[model samples]
Target: MKKLVNCFIGLTIGLFSWTGALSQISIEEFAINFSQPVDIANAGDGSNRLFIVEKVGRIQVLDEDGQKGEQPFLDISSKVDSDASEEGLLGLVFHPEYQQNGYFFVYYTATVNSIRDAVIERYSVSADSSLAEHSSGVEVMRINQPQSNHNGGDMAFGPEGNLYIGVGDGGSGNDPGERSQNLTLPLGKMLRINVDNLPYSIPANNPYAQMGGDTVREIWAVGLRNPWRFSFDDNYDLWIGDVGQSAREEINFISASENVGGLNYGWDCREGDIACPGCGNNQCDEQTFTDPVHWYGPGPGLSVTGGYVMRGEFYNVFEGHYIFAEFARDQIRTLQLSPGRSVAITATIPANNISSFGEDEKGRVYAANLSGIIYRVVEAGILPVELIAVHIKKENKKVFLDWETGFEFNASHFEVERSLGQESFKQVGIVPSKGDAGEITNYQFIDQVYRPGDYSYRLKSMDLDGSYTYSMNLTIKIENNEDMLVLPNPALDKIRVGLPVMQEAGHLQIVGLDGAILHRIAVSPGDEDAIEIDVKEFRRGLVLVQFIGEGNISFTKKLMLY
Candidate 1:
């Protein structure tokens, strides 16, 4: 079995306390059992689904909950060339208007008549919305491959909706054909094309789009050995993970805002910052090409697996970090770029065989390995409470709050916080925790003096080392002896109900418009003021949330699920 590590905030603080302790990030398994997964992408649709590209010519779907679908969304194994380990289905991207056009594209290696070639094709989703129609595929472009090892099968859509394809120099030990620097060949260059047209059209802004002679109009940038993976950040800046020939693995970057192109990235001339040994100084002119933004010696890793910049809210600490990994090292690392364009490794994750890095619709990052598992990246030391739920309720003249935790590691206490209206929460009360325990622990607090109005409450879980994380905010309305608040009206996956402090017990029911009761939850005096209910499994539409408290105090609200 593969070794799995689950580090809950406070439990592994010491393990990540490095030079920049606060900058480190951690990982937890998200999904497993994939066959040679090479890439991951989202449809850009509101469905919040993830598409995993397996190198064996299939695309698997993972729902928002990280559960793999029973059937693949797309499969084209018959046309894929899997004879070479590096050849097969390699890249996938959904059109910017995928939600409307249902168009998606994939890059793969195809074998025909004992020769292998790289192909890019577009496909549309099936009428069922869950599966892709293989028959809907239309060939977009195809390039003859001289050798299979360095096919450079990765494609991504730029901010302008143009497709950028990475092609390796005709594969061999070195650029024997000098194809990278040759403006006439598409090999070893980033190609840009407008795929909205039949057979694709060259982007007008491409470096050689209008150049006459033997110049290939699709060339964008040149001199890349094997750019295995690359991505565009929110700013449309391109980042490339170019596999090294002998000494260094490099990450090349280009800002889209520059608008300048036709630049050469030293490959045959230079492996990284140094000259390629035995290649001579024929084209090894440092001033002639752009050097990589970052590069590493061939010890800790071999090939570079470029990842996305952290734009997700789940890991706030890594907000602007550029995450990347190595194939041989099996390590996930982050880079922080200084204002001067210098880069530094801020964190490292001890993983194995990380083949690719992916993001969900919400921007949460995930890593996939050759071992058939994917892990979600999270901030290492935070959320010490591990709270299962936190709620609040209001009675005749008093308000009560309750919370439960599945486990606590070095937890010292809980600070009951309150805020009037939308103001910041203030410390109102403190409840000592059960110290450090692995079993379930429940706690509660009460406020006897409070005016009738709107109030919000949250729990501040504190650790012995002064670290803390806050729970989800729970709000309540104190009106004429009644209190209830159904939150996150437009819910994506789950909904929460805030109950009033009660003298006895009550029952809460969620009913659909068709007069069908979907759930019935019991509420008691010491129960949490707020209760979370998973509504993702429910149909998307309007639903009634009803709560009947002691003394027949009832309240209802309409919820919209999407």
Candidate 2:
């Protein structure tokens, strides 16, 4: 028995029983225009406001109270070299305890000593919150780049109260200094430091801190190409999206639980588990090397865009999927990876020339296009619960269904369908819709029935603008069976499934909850190794593991890799 609220306007809406969603919402227009919007962040301070960073070194503010203010929060273009597309203000991050500290960090290309280099600067907002004082910008950490191109840009704070920075391999072409794997250089790696210490100090427990060599103690993971973006989930696991050179693009997952530091992924040595012919030595020891859990080649429109592991409170269906985008590929791709398997692509949200993906305080993902359009991803056709309670009654014969259209996009009408059995469904009532809400309108329907039976209902909303979407199914079930044994629920690092212990060799496909295949492995039963797959190369979140044995027995299990 679920409770309903009298929340907003009295709206009658369809019901969501257990499964079946109502609609899929997409970006209708760009949120804010920018010459090049690299990233966006929300205050998370109960303020539905967002901060946008421009490539040319300016920060713009957009408030959710329906207010849009234009004035660079901080303009460093005069101090930065905005000539090159990649040279300007590259990254920005708000402090985890920003409400009190008011401290924020920025990564930019500064012309120091007549040589351009990447620098991270710390700034504090004024007591009035109107502007950040110019003198408050303090030098935190700086890394000198050998070449111009691979100036690793993004910087973020992990859940463990450490600042993580992205560093690309020293520019020019193919691993010139072989710097990605070299612990000495900060290029081409993810570095973490504790900001609680003065300025910033390397965390003592960092993976490479005890290497005893001249390596940077702050180096958390190395052997990466140009890692433009990296983020951590609530569980403190790290997710990295490294832009590939030519052949492939890869995403990585590092579990905080493992505490396995110094994770040296093969960069110039290998791209996504396949040996680079030019790098020589086709076969190398697999023990010391970590392979990418998810990777893809340069398809028609393909370039690795970083995404977020759906950890927001938006909806359950998309709860744990990793959402990413492709620049040249122009698609929002989600990756779900399980232990002992590669990362698999789950969902593909189409867009034109999308460059970056962003997440707000609510955990909703945003896609910004190179064309200067920004679209927030939302549930296409959804209504509030309070709206679902009205006109819904268990009459003697049939249930009366009525719902007021709340937020709609190109909505045509509501076609109510019912099912006694989960399979067979028939049209019961038709409710007409009046397109987009120039203004809200109410609608109703009734199914006159004589016998008492279980039923399920769904809304088929069509867009007069030529689009169609369905709502989550509403079940009035009489009885149901015990849930299937979906083993390895929320698997961490690794997973195993028992299905009569087949002795056949077949292929295995790992998928996400959304039915997107995450990993496909060729396996031979009776092999002792149990197939060693690294999730470090894929995005972190909930994933599905599917195994097809030689006997054609298929098994599916849900897994979560931190």
Candidate 3:
């Protein structure tokens, strides 16, 4: 949800210092079935699991290795107030040394003494590391909010080992109280606190730490309408995507050297390099304000959702690029930061409704949308090959499978896997890929069965780099008694043939290709449904099995004796 929808200008919105064309990227679906998932994060612990924050006050655990737990890692819905569209459990971050301390924190809205407030509480992990011990919650900090729209609920542990919280200006049309520029209040400001000190303590270097009376000691930086999302890169540079009010949306850059606290981001006073449309007098406007590294008018987008630098090792193509998205525009793009703090829109990605972006322990990137789906960003032309058409045919105790791929790229091969009953899937066969080409490729695999049972089969599409994805399951059932079908088609000594349920007796004969009878038997409707034949005395060759019943009714099938 956007804080402000005031698109007053036709916006010749300048995307300050940007290159026109950039490399193209795309997304592959990674996970699904979440409700209004608003944030993503990972525990610094070596577990490699990614935590998904749902807006309704629950955090889910998703493991990339196919071991997702059915229950949420943390569920605080009972204590969270999500009555307003903007109010809810919004943010989560694990302590840097979570493995040792088992500490984590949350930012959410809850009613305390009949007043709504933004609550920051600490919790610990349970013995089962994937879940949290619900009763361990300890209140860290709480601040009353005048409105729900601009809670600015985003949190991260800074390189200095302190917790920084982004608080939006007490929400209303155009900062009625001018809270953003006021350094005396915690609202409309970025606050830094030391959570290591239990209920939390003020950092000695916080801008207003020594200020007395009405001054807020937790205030580190002021003048932000709503810093909805922000991040600190490996370089310790703080990047913020502050939602706009009337005319422009912007991205602010705080380089490591300029991050020594007490910096103002022009919000209510000036929106994106321009003077606040209606304002106060004289040199009060001359107060030094840090300009956005990039800004754009409402013509392009209304709200900006901040992103992280792609520093993951697996996907190195976007090595140093900065990625961000527009909540109202439903688009994701990347910016490459050149020297002098100037950045350009260098790439566009194919994803939609992206409410937030997240990174895993391996630095791999992921994104989640309001529509309950999670996507993984991938290079444009290298998606894993998928089977577009698949078919199965059962004949004489043999299952024949065929499938086709619409396109292939860096494909290694396909593995045919099968599951019997509820057993785990096991590889049955492998078919080498047709190499990297845009043309459709057809492949086939045959699964032999000697016993009749239910079978489920699927393809495992492989990439040259060893990554793989599975196709939907195709199920085929092989029954022992069907017409005059034969089990153990290529028999060394014996075979079973279906017996016809007849009104009278019938003779079952195995006739060789040369018209000689190899075996014979009498089957009646009152007897068993199958007749076993011995062929150990016969030479290894193809033969036909014939069944003659009442009214000249007969069924015949070709069989192989090995």
Candidate 4:
């Protein structure tokens, strides 16, 4: 009956796009008919066929283009004892080297004599691309559970060729058994193991193995309550969204290269830096267990939904952003991370009972709803904002104006305008759009040959119906001055700087490619002979060098640091 009600709700909200209030994000519902789809995975083989995991122990196929396939790829519902509610099929993973191995693994509650145990079983598809129930599964590993609730379920292959698994705090709120904090137990922790060798092999570099302690050798990072889902970015950064008890929901990020062995995420010790009554101050070590970079409490949702980092080139704002969801309230939020260990919310998408987020071969993300609908997050582009960029070059005075349809709307053309000072303006040109780009779109117009001195440009992206909106004016100045230069474009260790002679001190700032300011210093050619900027701590990316010298002169240069 509950499933029937959920199906009805999904059918009711099936026809429209879910747009949240904060940012210009649009969602399209696809693969609507399913029985409690919990997670989805792409084959990455250009087949466009997506494997959707049903929590009730089944794998359905969605066509590469996101159309619902007529049949399921695999179903082990009879083998699973889901009487315990959380016991059915929880996670599924395809071997990264699957083309050669033809291997797959599933995490589920296998029932034997009415006793349900958390098990990871490996299965291979038949030559016909179907699974058989003739007991063709090999039990890779199994952990006996006293209770059923917190079966931290989700698995993914990391860049280092390791399979990572998430385990819960062994059920019942507040971690009654304290299993998450106990390194000896696998519960309430994330485990990483190498499956290249038959069943599974423990990696030599696994933090616990080298540390020589009571920690579980397969444990990657510990102290997680119940991480429903976690995935690695293209660069292998691990983003884990762990479910909170009562007060918080968190998103944890760890750099792949930085080996933080036995990193405790303060589950019972702390939830997002707030102490729980059960965890005392004296018990909490001053070692500063890494708290979540950002977290929120249940305001609109019951549980926190984990998502993936968008590395696809199709969208700009979504790139490098971690898109997450709230299960109870159906809100999709984006966390923008900075090099300096800071994060900000760029946008939040609207959703309902969003159980999991999946990625396809093209790197676009998909959100699975318990309401029986699956939605893919595509770059609908920002609503057409009237804006222009002015570039001044010798013999080529150019003005670039960009506009597009805003969220949930369609835009058509853009009218460009030019201003001499800040007041008097004249019509420049009219750029026509390719019609309504249902999603956010980026359009540009260039105007050549303009008068000297400072110039400003504005634009209005109009709708096909004659309604329009204005854009922020862009300003540019035509000038030539080689005031500063950063040697060794791909800089390392120490970077040399050459500054033009100035009367007073100048301010120097190093901004990352993401517009994050990393280093700032005041330097004056008259005061200091030269400045050597340190590039050791910098990661591989494009950087901006800003120099503000005497006479308030500002110079910007892009530096590539490896």
Candidate 5:
């Protein structure tokens, strides 16, 4: 999660300043539509698949091409209670080691014997990797819900690998039972636990894990009315959107590195720095509880929906701002926090009914609307070039770079920049582009003098009017060993291989797992530095590409065909 602070450049179209100032932001609608979509997430398995959760207890799967699967990944509608507006499937998270274990967890509300309960369950993926094994589900924890509306249903895995769950104050209006201030209850609190075991084990560093005598050991923080949505930033700082009681909506911030947990947010006693009527003598004590970082009166919005801090690569002005929305206002706003705990409004989005926010593995942010639509956050203006894909490969001692663009408008040229380590990138080569093209175009460049190390490559596209923008960066590691470079991995249709000149006199074979040769090609001396192979005929699974040199020097590299 390295920050690209220095990569920001001022272009002729508009100069962006990182200071706390308002910037124009826009949203692009995604192609796929969902039915009351509440949350969206990626599995982090490098498969580039998106999992969308609907409020009616079903999870839909979408591939990288925006095509949804024919069947739902998981369905629990029979066991879930969606009678109320806010009581249904709420959250979903994949295990940090899900690529190996195939384990995932979900939070939902179920009814049994006419009583509603919030249940956290874990399920394993089937052998097909596209569907879940519903029969293998095991309940991890269940809490009885007294009422329905205020059930806080947001959950996420923190950077420390512990699960954090946000709970509401047992669902009455204005402190009827005073559950938030009660230390013996898990309601209206943030809970942390380790799910590596069968039944979850409380983390040893939890604030009240070892405390006995009716104190809930799973409680990490208390005093929340209804935390509808919450998220952790790249720095692991916790941000929550606590819906207020009468006239206020608030956003609270807690730093994971500085705070030791056990913080009281003052729900029944106070509302957003104001004393609650008839609760605890009507005298607010600022020293007793932690106040919200930002709050607003009930005019433009009613309930706040918390969103992620802008760590995505699409916008430079939104790099360090916290983005959130109000359910009633249907507007998205950004907050910038200074070192002295001061907050300022940076930008506003014109979206509507933003129920939740989501981020992919590449840090791209998406907004899920309760109206059954999803939008991706993007910069306000159009770019000179629409880059489709970029690939880099190390061939022998030279590095080859290739990219494709769907369209180009008023384009001038593309500068290929290379960086060693995490330092600033330098221009290595430049490729001229078509001034204007409505069809697909391809370009390539080669760096013949790069050293052996970690390198990153990016394209800086400049327009005819001198305005420019950058494409997403690609990183590749070069080793001293004699390993061929493969491009566009997890490839579709075709793959290109780069080999060293010394190893050109060899035989290359594409072999399946059953020791059957699917394709073979003879390597001759003085052949080209790269070879393109059509893999559309290969089966969709794991295959090995082996090379046998003149001295019987053979090595195999695993290739995934899809």
Candidate 6:
């Protein structure tokens, strides 16, 4: 039901206007109608379709032209535990022989006997070719999670056809247990195992393979603090975006040409080339650990979302550019590592939570916003704000309109347009934008109805350059008097309900989804303009605001509180 309305707003907004060597990078919505997408991958079965993994335990299929299928390819929402935003159906990968074996794998967090476990499981596709056989799931690995915050939930098959899993240091501030450097557990390491065997097998070349001291044989590389996302280039070179604790964000790169195992990436003691403080006083020598190839601190981002190296149709100058994003600041960057780590900041994409970045079969990169929109990363462009949602509601002789934004670039203002029935739309109100990049902004407008007819409304998001895009139309029919207007919906703390001009008294009841009343207030409407309902104590999510008036209850409307 949260599917976005703007699909064709910026179909060609500077997506192909720049081809310079150092062109700025931007993004456009590639697919819509996803619910909290955290990761995306392509099944290499020659279909070229992208499979998006949602935090609610569903994997959906989207075709090349941004078209998505109505049905999900896989659904295991019942098996996954996503109570914690950090945990969910996080990663997906197809078997090298997916065309024949119909096999694929997923990584998620689930509760077993009251303990959360990071689980890796495999499944085969159903006969329908688009759905997975529910009964064909097989558990490959399950590691007990120490906390919910830092489950490094991403996976990929190395160039050697083995599964490589990224895990976090047993989650707490500063790795209290010092698990990343511990070899006895898999908590904070890059684990490589052979999935061809049931329940998985340890690769012989792993660091601990020859050791007999109870060291984990699944450990390939050690000392990583939440390797949230990582990928490999054609040469099997690894690029890691390690999320920092408090100081800085760092990227770990391991060239396959090095041909070595048991590489240690410093954590707990070091963060982003600087000695970490408040880390339980742990110390390390400069020779004991490898530092990041590139690092940056706060304003840009501390929650780094790793990305891929472009290998297919890309900007003319970025043949080997490694593109990544900062989840904290909603910014993307391109890096060159030939001579040394050289980084360039890309444009800031909105809906700030950039959970993950993925590449399609053609090597076109895309970014996934946890707020439910996937965007295609392209060369320099003006990324405009898409009116993702527009809600229209009526209360006594008046219609209220409100909507939310996802991306904004050089945004000027918004013009609210209204139409009567099939008539042409005319501008009714102009709302100035907050103009803050990387922030979620909301706008509202109201139109009065004198006669009974259907009314439609849309928004014209105007850019600084004078280019404008129209959002999908929202229509509502008027049968009676429609006046209690609610402003700042999807609100945070409070909302003002515009009461009827003549009405003086009523009872306001806040109802939850379970049909239970959460708050009750008596309104003494008089000289006041509107009734201010304090919803700061109510839980975040959907709630019904009902007005109990003279003879019958005036209106029951749904208000979203985030």
On lDDT, the leading prediction is: 1
**Candidate 1 to truth, TM:** 0.66
Could you say which candidate leads in TM-score? 6
Score every model by TM-score: 0.66, 0.63, 0.65, 0.63, 0.63, 0.69
Clashes of each: 7, 30, 1, 14, 0, 8
Give the higher-lDDT candidate: 3 or 5.
5
lDDT of predicted model 1: 0.79
Task: Report RMSD (Å) for each prediction in the order shown.
Answer: 18.3, 25.0, 13.5, 26.5, 19.1, 12.5
- The reply for model 3, stretches above 4 Å from the true place, is 1-23, 112-114, 278-284, 299-301, 380-562
Q: 237, model 1: CA deviation in Å?
A: 1.7
Worst 10 residues of 5 by lDDT: 1-10
lDDT of 4 by residue, 109-176 (tens): 77687565789988776676544233568888887765788787799998678899998878877777
- Model 2 over residues 80-145: C-alpha lDDT tens digits? 776775577888888888888888888888776778788888888876564677678888888888
Stretches of candidate 1 exceeding 4 Å from the true structure: 1-23, 284-287, 299-301, 382-562
lDDT, model 4, position 321: 82
Candidate 6, residues 216-310: lDDT per residue as tens digits? 88999888899989999878989999999878788888888763678888887788788775576344665377789888874333698898887
RMSD of 5: 19.1
Task: Give candidate 5 regions above 4 Å deviation.
Answer: 1-23, 277-287, 299-301, 382-562
- Which ranges in model 2 have alpha carbons more than 4 Å from their true place? 1-25, 211-213, 280-287, 298-301, 338-344, 382-562
